[model samples]
Target chain A: MSDNAAPIQLFAKKARVYPKRVWGTFRKLKWASMVVLLGIYYLAPFLRWDRGPHAPDQAILIDMPARRAYFFFIEIWPQEVYYLTGILILAAVALFFVTSLFGRVWCGYACPQTVWTDLFVWVERIVQGDRVKRMRLAEARWGFEKIWKMALTHSLWLVIGLLTGGAWVFYFNDAPTLLEQIIHFDVPWGVMSWVLALTFSTYLMAGFAREQVCMYMCPYSRFQSAMFDKDTLIIGYDEKRGEPRGKYKKGDSWDDRGHCIDCTACVQVCPTGIDIREGLQMECIACGLCVDACDGIMDKLGLPRGLIRYDTTHNQEAREAGLKERSHLMRPRTVYYTAIITLVGAVMLFGLMNRAPVELHVLYDRNPLFVKLSDGRIRNGYDVKILNKAHEDKVYSLSVKGLENVEIRVQGAGEIKADQLHVYADSVGHFRVFVVADKPADARENVDFRLEEVGGANAADYDGVFMSGKP
Target chain B: MSKNNEIDKVSGVETTGHTWDGIKELNNPAPRWWLIVFYITVIWSIGYWVVYPAWPTLSGDGERGGTQGTMGWTQYDQLKEQQAEIRARKSAYLERFENASFAEIRSDEELYAFAVAGGAAAFKDNCATCHGTGGAGSAGYPNLNDDDWLWGGDVESIHETIRVGIRSPHEETRLSEMPPFGDMLSGEEIADVADHVLALSGRAEDSEAGAQVFADNCASCHGDNGLGDSALGAPNLADAIWFYGSEKGDIMSQVRKPKHGVMPTWEARLDANTIRQLAIYVHSLGGGEE
Candidate 1:
């Protein structure tokens, strides 16, 4: 012990925050982003795209049982999962690009936590009243007025949470059909459980957790400084001009005094309730409502606006040093991130454009590698599987090469009428093909088989081995 | 130990009677809810020990090994219950398959689906040994999922073949024999006929010379284009599917000393309903004909 200190306190009770509502440029931007993002989330599942009678028609769907993912006109089979990885990489690099230029702008404006919490707070304000009234009501004794307002506010929040959860399940199933099934209580128990879980989490996150999710739960907020640079824009106070804060008088001399009036308007309007004059803090969401509050007071006082503003640290330092503003946006980090994002996007687009419409897989019989007929001919059996990715049935003609005098026999696929094989649309056709060669050179030889569409340009080939070894 | 009971400077909490390098630990109590969760887990573990098979017995008897819980829960018992539930669920399909006629079953899509599912299970359990897992038959056995059946390829014929078996000891087995041709024809004659059969499938270089030999020695059972008669259980030598093999040496050996394979009568081993299921399953393997 130092012998001059008091006993330690391990815990401190949380001070309830009642941020006074304010409007500005950032507030309008945030409101616009929330509307656009939430609108897309709730309505995208209902958007329909006409896939033929054999496939789902949803514009964006994850058809689990069919093992297919449909995005508008593009259908992705199970084998095409790498496209999702490409998308994730693109999104991550794009986020890095945006963050390097704008700092925690995404966290303040478009994060789901911020948007849902804003909606919940707005609902609470409508049911109750403004900040002072809400604070008073919280401290007041239980009454019918308080009880009704609290109940109404919570019920509205729950309704929003329910809709949020309900919209999520529609992406996995046909939206209109699932809605009908859900209303009639015919939905599966597993689907119902997912809906309930999502509903509870949304309600808990938006209603009561509020800013705690951004501060304590979200990992992005913890590592946000890594993306920030001296030139990156952030919400900051002009300490050089506004410091030595004090209340102003009408006949003040304007000598040996800073411009700040110390009205605490900026602190009062802060969503995370941190004093901006204390420099930047991790809890500050940089939403810029404080800037609007300060600007309003400055206008009233006949002073220049922007006592709090969105500005870069380097620009602020240069201005204080009486130098012209200069920005360095073409940094090495941003250039590399941009290049990687472009490369990934281009590669994925190229892959999607070049994907073949037909695929061939050959499974040579493992047991009895080859059979010998009385005619001195060696035979090998193969399960030739042809996947027709087209939307309509296709007739494919089969041919074998790389071995002379090879006879192809497909069981039940009678006579090689031009060596044709019929495969249904969007399905795999399996044929037991027996390749016979009279007096095969050596015990085994590499052979190539091709399945060419009877009248179309699409074709696929597989290299297989013709075994003439003992059975 | 000298500064163990002293208070920490900054936190304003009492020391925890411990110190490490002049940094005193705080005597802070855990959150009440956290302690409640801890107590709950302690109680849950005791309850679990009482309800489930937990401890070994002192007796060390090999049979009555462990202490049985009050609930009498065992992993084997759980498995049996799960299996029983699955069987109960499938009983509806079984009842329909048992009562419906083969024609009736085939006409109803739902009944056919049930039969196919039940038949697939039976096929894997009983028929997968001889017939490859997918009915892609081995060298000696005929591939059931092909159109190259010796007797016939129709569903009815398949049912009869499965019930009576081929060359089985059963009284009504489908019996046939191609008397070893080596006794009558020379080895060179057999080789020539083999080439003629290969030429029918377009595998041989020439069939002009062997065509005369084939007609003279093999036309009675093997029809005119080397397409054998299915009515008498003779395979179509014109096709590429060779039961024994397709090699020249294999054919010469078979002509010299024909080794006929026998299939046991399934009716004697399996129930009639199961045999019916096997027939439907075999018929559904894609190569079954009308």
Candidate 2:
């Protein structure tokens, strides 16, 4: 719009950031979430589940060796991979639910990047002083004191990293035992290596990479626009109200300009250091620290609050035009997100309820589908697979029915004195059984294979085409 | 860190200065000690990756992925170490349980204490699923460690129950199956016979017309006394130990429907020594019928 053709665009000069601390409701929420989420991650592994004597006692463990995953009361085996799928769906929809309701709440508060960076910043404040001092220290001449500052800060960061790494491996095994093992310098190689790798990454990401992860590497940051709309409550600066901004003395009245004193305190406290007055940028985490800072400034200046606040474009425009609209939280997109979240949750619960403890699989012996004995009886062979899904073994008998006048024969199964064999718990057992179809040698396609536990008749049936030259 | 380029060192590690969000570029070198530690760990991990079963394939060519390191270290070896530790502890318990006479061990002061500690843990792991923790009885699963036993509760019988287990196909395993009364009698006739059978156990909800059918057909295994035969694995009808259930409907269902419980063969799954130990362990649980 600037009609000065001779003027070439000069890229905005970068300013070194030193965000001063600000506290308010959003900050408190962020703090509480950080504590709770981080607490669960670090402490969960130390909790114990007495799964009798046989199973590992570490609750919420991911037992890689045994291929078991335990979460409190729920134990999932590798075979129950659908549970993992359900979990992934639950995670996705749950995110949608959270996003729709609070609007970027996860990004502002619960995102690992936000939480860990908060922690690292706290540690940095404790060791090297606040943002101002840290900035000054970095800019200070290379002296022994500066060296000490860097060493102290980096050391603290690495300690947090080490703790993070240590906590991560605990999820895989008994945390207390692993900790002891690590201290003794005899942790399992796989575990130790993973801990080392995780520690290094945590240190680098939280300490050095910092906000760059969300800015450059995070996929969520790149595509969050697709999920956003004008109605969504975003960290917004009311330009109509704050524009014509100019410096105001402590109590001086200015009727010509807006309430904004242009103190730029909001900019100074912003974690991303982006001026919200420029409109919603992809970089804004919507942390509301700016809102808190601006509110503090407006209160001191005796002006109406909300220089920067959670608001919408539509609401801002309506307010300016003197016709207000009620805030809409139940938009179609939010409704869709909630419905999807509930649907996925219901499906997961249903799946958990209907899970079977015992199952069966039958493989037909295809090499010789059927054989004709000299006695003129036809025999169909089958490889019956029995799965004992229970924690205990099963003694199930192999029997046949659904075909008129058929005698069941099992090759390895001792004389028909009994029909059952012992199947191990959490394992599959295969038996080669021969069914003497009493039908003529010309019979075909009409038979059922029944596996019944002798005396204990929890029977399973498999229907196979009884072949005899296709009838 | 840039792909396919070595650091010239003259122009040091300068970051690309594009700050967005609060993330800014820092012009600094990776800590020398940090990089050294990183390299060492990476090299060590690669060495481990090259030597272990790190990858899986459907073709069963898993060995092709690893170098088969000089020490031949494997997950199996680690598992073996754990197993060895377990075995060491187990041997102590097994020696005391299997070697000591039940009465002698049961009566002794210290020996009983040790057996209780070891047996409690073992039962929790193995027997608790079916036998119930602390030998508490469920419908189908029996109450071990109780005086009530169908076969015999003597040391030998107890050992036998534990060795082969009831209704198992462990070669010398205990075995039995109730004949399908459905095949033997018409549905109506079976109900009559069921009533008669229930009557023997003082649980008659019907007439005595079908008592002859029981005396004629069922007495062979159930005994003329209706107390049941141990050799035939016939359940004692007189006692309250109903294998399926103890209710009138349950008893009638058994008479008409019949209840047959199966015990898996312990032979292939458990080692001979372990089976011996388990037998003694079950015997100590009390239902080792003499």
Candidate 3:
């Protein structure tokens, strides 16, 4: 350590970014994506599907109290949580496939953070004017116009955040009922806490954090380059054509000069405030807004478009060499990701289609595993749980096989039939069943409890063990 | 420590003035927002210490309990509050359970389910020591799940038996005593009677000499056909189930000197509602009669 050296500062203040409003093809594409994504998120909970009389009609709901997840006609029980794993795998592989072809497409278009921040910036622009006016107001004194405009912008951002948070909670409950509760200011504490938490996070992340979230916080931005190869499409600058730049008048000659005029249009319109002329960087979201800005400038100057554009490293090299440019969409990474997505999607679809309506679980008694009745028969007590997922009450006849002279007795079933057990719709029937069998040759015997729906095709079987005293 | 004050020539960045071997660290600062978050967490920890019990304290009079924070919260108090909430939820079912008769409780499905759940919990805590976890009793303790019962298997009878207990210290206990016949009968006579008792259950051939002794000694309480009377707490002899044992030696020993089992009355030990739940639970263990 040096004694007379200048003191080292450990923290650097953030440089605020003010992205000027730009209009082009990619800007219009971003707008369309934001509208569609937000529309689906806010309106899907209100959609309804008729699940007959016994089940809830909400189209997409996660009923925590009931331990059921209903997505349109498909209902998932807690035991079938592997479906969620399959969905996650499918989503991950699909993202990989898209990223291998078009770099950071998910980050630029579909990500909630980018979409909400763009919406927030638009609200700011509407209230405080565009980039120059906003910077002027920030530097100006706190006058009545500045205060009211800033307050209005923040108030609008908060309202948007509240709506976003309120929409999120609707997925876990009946939307109409929760909306009514919210209208009356009678929301439950659990739902109210979640709504408030989400509201605060959305406001902070969208209104204040902005591009810093993608730069310093998001893991996707840090690791997404791993999916990129030389063939992957990325936003870049053509340094071979745009270097040795200088300002030009209307009548300037085109000899001994590059096409770039050093206008800084790409940098001014960048959401993250990074220059594409600096070459490929991690901060670039591949949003193509720079391409739009450059194309508009080229139209004005009678020069060709794509001084800064979406291009692969290989294509750029080929163009510089005066060769043809080609896209490789069927690379090894893309093929592997596609195969995984297909395999997981197929397995999930097959499981959903073949889901059984009945499930049987048999728990053998732990203490005194077998009781010797006075009649020389060994009786084993079992707690049998029958999950009847049908919409109507079902009667199931239970029988035990692989044991000699097995007699079944169900407690509290009231003699409708010896083997018939009535289970209510969409609920578990818990029965204390005692299976009495004649003394077997061995001390223990493997048995199967077969439960078949009465006059129906649905059936379930559970493998169990019958214990007797050692011979 | 020495002042280098030199910039690295290759990267054109200043050094942090510390060198390890040939390496000099760059003078790149972290983002200000990260430092601001660290400061916020530090302040939050200070606020947490004020709001929660964090430091130990000693009183002027030498008491050593820790300082009670502004919230005045403790884990024991939280546990007590949670337990109170559970009791409040169960009071609705417990009130009905206490008032309803055994038949009324049995007929109502919801009330029966509640009673059974309560009974199962209470059984594990209080009764599992003697009667097994599944109510399969050992040599002396009666298995509540079996059809053969000494003091009736109906819900009401089970309730009464649990309340008073057999041969217990309670004044109204179901009292029964089999007089020891070691001096009254010869050893040969006791053996013959044991054979006749086993014969009744088809365990032995009909013993002509033992029949007269069993008729004179056991017929009054065990019945002539050996179907036991529930009121007298006498076990049935004709059934294959045996309290002591079914062997000839066991029967002879029992006849010579009978061993009486004592069940403690639960009325004083547990509340009335818990006793009723226990009775319902024991009766529902696959064995209660109409």
True contacts kept of 2: 0.00
Candidates, ranked, TM-score? 3, 1, 2
Model 1 C-alpha lDDT per residue in residues A178-259, reported as the tens digit of each score: 9999899898887888888888888999988888887788887888788888888888899988877788998886577777
Q: Each candidate's chain A: what TM-score?
A: 0.89, 0.86, 0.95
Residue A264 lDDT in model 1? 89
> Where is model 3 chain B poorest over a 10-residue stretch in terms of lDDT?
B58-67
Q: Candidate 2 clashing pairs?
A: A397-A420, B145-B285, B145-B286, B152-B289, B152-B290, B153-B288, B153-B289, B153-B290, B154-B290, B158-B288
- List ranges where model 2 is wrong by over 4 Å: A1-18, A49-58, A366-382, A402-405, A409-418, A425-427, A430-471, B1-290
TM-score of 1: 0.74
How far out, in Å, is residue A464 in model 2? 4.6
**Per-residue accuracy of model 2 over B1-290 as CA lDDT, tens digit each:** 34423322333333456458955454576889999999999999987667765645556656554455655777778899999999897777667766777566656645555655555665677777776665655677765544456666665675566667776767787777777677777766666766766666566664565767777778888887567876777766665456676665676567666666766665566555455545555654423433
Q: Is the docking of candidate 3 incorrect, acceptable, medium or high quality?
A: acceptable
Q: What is the interface RMSD of each candidate, in Å?
A: 7.3, 22.2, 6.4
Interface RMSD of 2: 22.2
- Model 3 C-alpha lDDT per residue in residues A420-454, reported as the tens digit of each score: 78999888888888888898877878899999999
Off by over 4 Å in 3: A1-13, A141-145, A413-418, B1-101, B188-213, B224-227, B245-249, B268-272
What TM-scores do the predictions have?
0.74, 0.58, 0.87
Of the pair 1 and 3, which is ahead by lDDT?
3
A best-first ranking of the candidates according to their lDDT comes to: 3, 1, 2
